[model samples]
Target chain A: MAHVGGPVRAWRDYTDGAPPPMLQAALDCFVEHGYHGTKIRTVAARVGLSVPGLYHHYPSKHALLVSIVQFAMRDLLDRCESALAEAGPAVEDRFRLLIECLVLFHAHRSDLAFIAASEIRSLEGEARSEHIAARDRQQRMVDEIIDAGVAVGAFGTEYPHEASLAIVTMCTGVAQWYRLDGALTPEELAVRYDTLARRALA
Target chain B: MAHVGGPVRAWRDYTDGAPPPMLQAALDCFVEHGYHGTKIRTVAARVGLSVPGLYHHYPSKHALLVSIVQFAMRDLLDRCESALAEAGPAVEDRFRLLIECLVLFHAHRSDLAFIAASEIRSLEGEARSEHIAARDRQQRMVDEIIDAGVAVGAFGTEYPHEASLAIVTMCTGVAQWYRLDGALTPEELAVRYDTLARRALA
Candidate 1:
């Protein structure tokens, strides 16, 4: 189920063109202590800057969180797009690619994944709506993949939408407990997840 | 893969007594705002008791958290034991039974699951070690099941431990996002999850 033939890139490599250090630091702190528990000083300290300096980059703590969330959402969508493009003509291949991308994303950017999965409720107004839309889009991608698989008779499930939710939930949950120092590398972890995802739909 | 059995009573239900109301209130507060973010006054307010009155039951906020964690861990292990005993001989049936028990456990006692998953690290000394041991024991149960499945040639996986971790992580994550008013009941959710789990191992 692992995607063959690909140029792997680290998260930092992807962010070099337009880095958001303050947002990244804020996300790390938020993932560690949650939104309400994280303080501006802690975020600033993580970036080796003063609170005022961090504020100069982000207007407020809430603003920092909002920016971080938006950033992660956009990043996830971009990865999804790439996976869709790289995935071959086979529906099963596309499905496997999507799950592998999700696991890889969670394993690599766990701090961002944690916030994306858990902290959207803390956002307000347009920010919250935008994040929700992005989340729905991601969910829709899973739905579409399952629908395609079902159409091709490659997957067997009574409820496609619920199966999609279970698959996505199982993949996203990787962020909570996965460690960089664990037994498997991110790529290897993604392969294992791909197998589980395939089995889930089979 | 559904377990063919009636509902099994958990240790908590068969125990001699209920927990102190104060501790229940504390668990609710901790689940809502988290441990570091929760205040004694807030718990007191929720319970309709003075701060001093609340302290009469538990000496400190940390003490309340410790009590909640201990209760949750003990209850979870007891439930797992009962589910295993009731599941009978089939590996798939046992796995489904365990998943059903966990889904019901998380549905009725989400606060406890949340506290056990998130706040246990805050505990110190023997309290912390005790919680860690319980968590490890739970992981071991899943590990043993997967190992048995592999030995019997009923499950095919290159990485059983990783697969087990994925399954446990997925089930535990339901507590973080599932709502009572959602489209599925706890039983429905369990069935859906069992399907996904079976696919994952197929």
Candidate 2:
């Protein structure tokens, strides 16, 4: 299968490795102006590509938006899964790893952070449902960690699901105010948030 | 002072009364389809009034949006202050009260939550600055409570400000997903969140 001008390839297959720059430009524009407010022309201009050239890469503006979100979600989930596997079987370590992933995830992909926090609702039909399911799965992973900790007497919680939600929300909220140029590095923020989560769950 | 329709009553005063059926209609519209997307005529029609009648109560659509945010912010801050006073000088009690107020605030004024989270940036110049200051002041109150807790050794944290920000973000994030018809009441959610905060700081 030749990776030519196809919707799936334009969105998913970056084997040729040219789509990342376009996606990066789109992410920045979308974060600043919102999905509905952003225009393909602006993204193209930012990337130094003609509008038609941009369309050669992405069939439509919505396609670009969806691809950005889909790629970011997949990337985040993949990182968390790996972190969980590498952190081994301890529930506390797993939770800490997840929190750390969240902090670094937000730091590296602030554009995705903005979209995940603000633009998910704008997605429609299957895309919307898939995004919601992905988000719920992420939430459920946190819930499972908390529940396991509670079950084994490693973590104490009055309500595991609510506690999990609060923890995740607190960590994800870092994306709103965190600055790469600011005082703390993503690693430091992760450590701080991990401490906060441990204390919250303790 | 007569509470009837007149310029003698500021926008703040009108919010104290019934909130006019039209304003409620407008809020619903604004929340459903953002501030920029809502039409004045639609708001009027929802409340069974002429557009001019809607304009009579609010000078313009921009004023109406600002009024909604201002009213919600004032109400939330007032509740926080009242809770603080009623809870007295104890750090733990103040923290608990603040969380309780936050849960209830998010539950009651979900439209305001949507607007504050998504639309405040639309306001320009003095209006925007005023809203930001009010938001910062609310945050500072939370910080003060956390600092007091740290000072008294009621809370275990070297970074009181960061802990306070995390707690506030966690609580506010509830509004994004909370439903009145959900399994947990606002008070129940508050208790759950309060426990999480205590643990995180512990």
Candidate 3:
């Protein structure tokens, strides 16, 4: 299912822009502890800083989470756009590339992906709205690809909208279970996901 | 497709063997405030009890989370077994029944399902191990069905294990997005998913 010709970038490339060391440590804490469960003090402590020092960097734990989520979402969006642009002229090729990118992102950056997937409930107001907006944009990317494919009679599913959401959700879920010591590399997993997704779309 | 035969129970029917009302109340708090985020006092207040009274029922927050996860997993397992039995002799029928049962469980008991999927990280020792065992058993049921279908030339996928995990994850994720006011009924959603999953398995 992989693209056979031209330069194709993997989804693992997107997470290169990571948070700062302090924020990264804080994100790890947030992933292990629910956002509500994490304390600024604990996050600071993890990075060898006192509570007051941590406060200097992040006004609150909430700020840290907001930054982490926005970063992950934006990074993913930016990468998807780039990858899709270079995914050749075929709609099927573009769709497969999107799946590969999504699967790779979820597998490679499981922590950030986990926070994005599971902790949205802890966000509030503009933060929550912004995250949802980003998420919707991501869903739209998949939906549009399906539409493009359907336009060319390349794919058919009765539940187009629901199928879009299902495909996105299925790929995002790789973060929940993909393991470092497991059998497949991130690339291999992405290939398999792309294949399975093709089955769904076919 | 809901079973048209004798009474086909919803997956939530299994969770009907609910915890005590107080523990149930505590579960709501845990779902919102999270395992580390929730205090015994909050659970008690939600149920009109003192912290000491809450402690009288369940020793700690950890206990509450463990109870909730185990209950949800066991309940899902029991219902799936019953559903598969009545799903008849055809592998395709059995596969469709699994998706219906899974979609119904996730939609009806979303909170419990969410807690089970996202909070395993909060559990420790035997609780975590037992919950994972139950989850694995659920995955194995899905896998065995796929294997049966493949044996009969009813289904085909090169990555059987990965496809099984993907399908289970995809179905379980309905809990995260399925809303009571959404476009589809639980039954409607189940049929759509069974259709989509059949595409993947094809």
Candidate 4:
């Protein structure tokens, strides 16, 4: 029952905390082995703990997946929101900052970002709802920015909603390929995507 | 042993075949329950066969994943390459056509597309190599188009490689969120992204 439903949250508050170190370890293991291929025991061992001890941290493998997604989205939204707030009154300025926020997040904390996008299907019940809400919350930011821009003639699109999705999709993909050792640093990647985003809307 | 080493294939050709009907069945199960979550038995049963029958079709779950990704990529590459070939000499025309092909493929064959992008890490050895090669071949098409565009002063980007990757990444995310019943049709989405892509590069 994963991948159905749309709901919005308050959107006013999202945590900016780095995912706990265990989440990082679990993210690593999940990336190496598909969620089904990964054993909970392996995650624990990676963190220098036993399987039982791992349960003490998370009740089940599903819980781990849920927590990973929650924190990842939360982290992403927090970054985007802050960036949006920091940028000045102009919609284009805010739009440019949002792209920078997204590309840099994907480039910098790629593993967590990877799980955030790929592991949504594994989420169940409230976890799925909560995660989707966080995603929609992020999408809503893009939608609002675009909508606002369209209203003021700052942006022009016959398909404003799809434009938002395309922007997020494009920015999110940075995680799939970005590497610390890669040719372009996160700052550089963000700059390039920023240029692309401007051209897309212009 | 997943995610290792790259090799080039004879990239002389690619075809856009309708994925076999059987692929649809497998893609469903994989989406509901990721590669590891799916069972050979369940997949076979879905097709009204014994586990052994499924084994006759695919040697292992990993094999199943490899086939899915290869076919899905083939389908995508087929579409993108054809569009790239068909659009007139202008880089902008080719680029616009390329966006339409990608957006449409991801919108229509979303489940398979999801598995194709998300399940790459589950493959190992030659399977992984083959799939990445197919992907690189597709990326090479984008790179060539962008390089030619820049060479001819049709497209202007300081970072050609990152722009290509970002374009693919943005276009690919349509699968994760698109619905046939959603507000925008594939054609509409493509038109919108085309505008965005042009602006980004302009």
**Winning model by TM-score:** 3
Global lDDT for candidate 4? 0.77
Share of native interface contacts recovered by each model: 0.57, 0.57, 0.70, 0.94
Q: Candidate 3, fnat value?
A: 0.70
Candidate 1: C-alpha RMSD to true structure equals 3.8
Please give the RMSD to the true structure for each candidate, in Å: 3.8, 7.5, 2.8, 8.4
lDDT of 2 by residue, B40-73 (tens): 8999899888999889988787888788778778
- Residue-level lDDT of model 4, residues B16-94, one tens digit each, is 3456655667788888878877887888888787888778877787777778898888777866766766676888888
What is the lDDT for A102 in model 2? 82
Which of the two candidates, 1 or 4, achieves a greater DockQ against the reference?
4
lDDT of 1 at A196: 82
Tens digit per residue, CA lDDT, model 1, B1-202: 2443344644223232334788888887776666766889999998899999988888999899889888888778888888888888788877888887777677667667867776654687898898889888987888888888888888888788888888887788778668879998888888888888766876
Global fold similarity of model 3 (TM-score):
0.93
User: What lDDT tens digits, residue by residue, belong to model 4 across residues A70-123?
Assistant: 778877777677677677788988988888788877777788877777778788
Real contacts retained, model 2: 0.57
TM-score of 2: 0.85
What is the alpha-carbon lDDT for the whole of candidate 2? 0.77
TM-score of every prediction relative to native: 0.87, 0.85, 0.93, 0.87
Compose the digit string of candidate 2's lDDT tens values, residues A78-173: 777877876789988898888988877776566677776677756777877888888888888898899999999998777888888888888788
The Cα error of candidate 3 at residue B90, in Å, is 2.5
